[model samples]
Target: MTAFEATFEHEARPISRPLRIALLGYRSDPFVGGQGIYLKFLSKALVELGHQVDVLSGPPYPDLDPRVGLIRIPSLDLFACDSHVKALRWRHLRSYSDTFEWCSMLTGGFSEPYTFSRRVAKYLRSSAKPYDLVHDNQSLGYGLLTLQRRGIPVVTTIHHPIHRDRQLALDAAPNWKFRLLVRRWHSFLRMQEKVVSQLTNVVTVSEQSRQDISGAFGICQSRIDLIHNGIDTQTFTPNSEVAVDPWQLITTASADQPLKGLRFLLQALAQLRPDFPQLKLLVVGKLQPSGTTARLIDKLELASAVRFVSGISTEALVEHYNRSAIAISPSLYEGFGLPAGEAMACGCAVISSDGGALPEVVGDAGMLVPAGDSGQLANGIATLLRDPELRKELGLRGRARVVERFSWQRAAIQFSNYYYRVIANADG
Candidate 1:
């Protein structure tokens, strides 16, 4: 067993009653990203475990289980507006959080995490309701420190550090001007760095993330707890009724994001087209008209071979996975690789890059390729395409792995034990 598992086994204890838990997220719309998904599922799981769970969030609030309460914390939500400058009003100037958010957007800095924390801290301090614990979904802002200082038990979940994202963005910048803009937009990392160093009781989604969080934030490895994220196996299960498309491949990615490594996948798709003229890619994400991925698609002359879809429902996503012969997760790095796990749960033959924590999720059930290598991605895709028996075998094994290892019910139980430990330590 791993050192973390050993430690958890020794210290874990059962709580006598359900917990009044508060989950915090700066912005939580599942369509926005993984954080929203994390909040949505985790909250639902906790409620299933008979805990009173409430999600405190900013604009683009999460679509949560009806049993879980949502306390909305308003922000400027400048990104939703066509023009940040025009979005600001005289009333926004009245609140410091609003003013800071507006000004930060004007200067190309992201202040949502910092501002969200401030709003949450104020709300918690003024409200009479008592929470056994405040779980932060990676805001990592100074306001978390404020709650800790106020004698509140705070457990922050650092789902891989934003430091990794910043460095990757810097590496992908086309020019000095773009590099400068990238640095400016990620300025919140400074606050995150400071806050993480001071906070006690921190946790992460995977072992890779536990190590990365330590390296990126200068924390000790033993200080962070690990709880692997789960897939809703019931929702993502394979549909034997849906016929698989042998020539089609599917992937989920934010097409324009450098960290997602969609460019490499596109390159691989281009390489395979000559050999497999019928091969096509279905990307489950929006295609930005002027983004890097769009330009790459044009240059590769693979526009007709690719299709992009966004804002899809869970049932639709599962159906897509069921219909595809293979699912590929080409991310350069992932905290827990939810898409990969979900695909595995759906019984797709997965071709995943050996990126951060992806190997941990894919395990021996699927094919692995070196991250960011288009040549190897193409080879892996070709191998899966040509071998129908292998695809069927891998699909069954992938589904079994997800069912046996990753489930929200199991995750919720582990988290319940972890929560009691934190509350006990705080009480002592």
Candidate 2:
């Protein structure tokens, strides 16, 4: 661990007050995204620390610990169902927020963050007792401002700005039409940028993210606190008995998205296949069977070698990590690379692209390749696959790094201290 990380871990305060926390998110699904995983583990950790957490979420609500209460604010994008576009009930039209959410998405604008925050503010206004603090998960919007105006102490966790996604997507797009759509999809960043600057206290997943966000969103650096995200080390630990296959490599890919760089990884895999016929890519996401990924696999004639697995238990995921000798994180950008950290925590050697906060997360524990470089990725994976001793050594060191530096207990304590500071500052 770096000296700074070690110091932060050592200085964390373990509080016993059992504070009431209102954790807010626009969307969370335990297995799918980092926000959901953060909510799931953080809420569970807060509960472990003797606090009560109630999650207020929108469409595709998080599957949190049973102890955490869920107040689902229904969205027109129910279950992310594409079919919901045509099946809106008349009663749904009565809800102006729901109608706006549906119309915004249909018109190519992502409106969940704005609509959800409005609903959350409305809910809080009607509740009998206000929460001790309101913790927002990146949905910086006007309603959050309302909460602050009403004297509810609020702290937001900005897991990096959405502008990075827009920039990367614009750079990747072939033409102006796609760029326009990309801008439309991320239209809510304007709301976030305004809201973020006004929010009193903000938490970020890493120092790198905090710095990047401050620069990207033009927010003051002092307003953002760095709370390194955790690895569920016990659940994601090494599986020794699962024999590591020499030619099998694994990665988590959001198949439908371009920013995931799954296409680049697939292209690299295509290059490597002729030289290493036994090689296979095990992707841990639902394959968009009809998307560009499937077409690319067919074009590369790797349809038989690539496998996609989804909805597996944490144990099953760890098992998959163990089955592979090495793991790859090929994201074009990441707020904090959880897949890299999780693979590292599981004792699997990792090769991660130096995208966004990934290098910050890996911190010499694993190999670093330039983002979007298919040749470099192929070389890194090939080297690790050929060198078992190097893989094992890196794997051991990576696991040690996460255990010592990134733990939910540590995050919870740090967050609790920040909670106190925010509350004290508000009162003062």
Candidate 3:
């Protein structure tokens, strides 16, 4: 018999008992993107709420809380090495899964999720300890169906939809060839769409994301749950010692991706520079060498005025937030705008685009501009630059807003309840 059908005492516990949760991620590195950040904090929060949380991730493993277990699910990790060809080993050929990954990356295809799922399925079959449920961190891999068949109740959080990013990148591609390459890179959306529809319990960060996921994956709205992501106010709070730089604007974005709207921010900065020569930008992300963003920065003639900082610690990020006069979220879409919320938590004035769930998070605490509008973004920056009193007031209001509505503690409680709901249904 399965664990779910074991002796009554072993199979079912008191409703108050702390759950055993396995959080799955195909690839998670906290500094890489928002998904990694989600895994890091949610695992930490779940553990703090007295649940046993194990994060299963493939290489570039996440920096997780010490108490939360990290089960390193190894992959080819081709992206980490100097060259994909050089990264290949004889052991890789021994496994068809690894061979597929090597071959996929060789041809500009992403095969991590597919191979990672096979690894996860194998591990679950042999794992001595069983879990009450598996909470997926947007992997949406076929392993989830395997888990369900093996009696592991599964729920997943679809953080917006990859299809949205794929479309935005395709639209921004300079030529049909580049668009075809983009299409090939994002072909996993087909699997995600199929998997999302089959899963019974789906959670998303915002109502905006829920609608987008439903539309993008053609899934029913009733299957998705809304869980507002939280900001760590204690760690991201205002540092009075770090004086705000008057002319420096800050934003966190994925440098080359069209969905981030970083290109538009660069355009807005170029527009503002002549009027405000001292104006500088602190970009909290990598500026890939020889990439579109790098070329655009040179074209805009703002090389000296813009600086990129990546892979900084949370403390360092909080310091950056405190040091800026205004923080901006220029994402074309975000399931939940963590950077804007972090800025607000740091007592910094914010100007965010009404993209995805940003307006929902900013909520009268910050200025809102239309997404992809460089002129409006520039004007919003200028307004904050001219008005110190307004900035101070907004900063105060933003901090208060974070304190009132957002916290990991609250999110953990909600998630624990959600977990029990899924578990209870499975048991019944």
For each candidate in turn, the TM-score is 0.97, 0.95, 0.95
Sort all candidates by lDDT, best to worst: 1, 3, 2
Q: In candidate 2, what are the lDDT values of residues 1-428, reduced to their tens digit? A: 33223446457667848789999988888776889899989999998998889999986878888999998977776446767578578898888888888788778898889999999999999998668999999888889999999989998888887878788778877799989999999989988888888887777897778878989889777767788899999889998889988888899988867778898889889889888899999999988778778888899898888999998888899999988888999998888999899999999999999888899888889999999999999998888877889999999999999998889988998888778777888888
Model 3: lowest-lDDT 10 consecutive positions: 1-10
Clashing pairs in 2: none
Model 3 alpha-carbon miss at residue 419, Å? 0.7
Model 3, position 171, has a per-residue lDDT of: 96
Off by over 4 Å in 2: 1-9
| Residue-by-residue lDDT tens digits, candidate 3, 166-231 | 999899999999999999999877888778778878888887898898889887776678777888
The collision pairs in model 1 are none
Comparison by lDDT, 1 against 3, better one: 1
* Best prediction by lDDT: 1
Candidate 3 scores a C-alpha RMSD against the true structure in Å of: 5.1
Off by over 4 Å in 3: 1-15
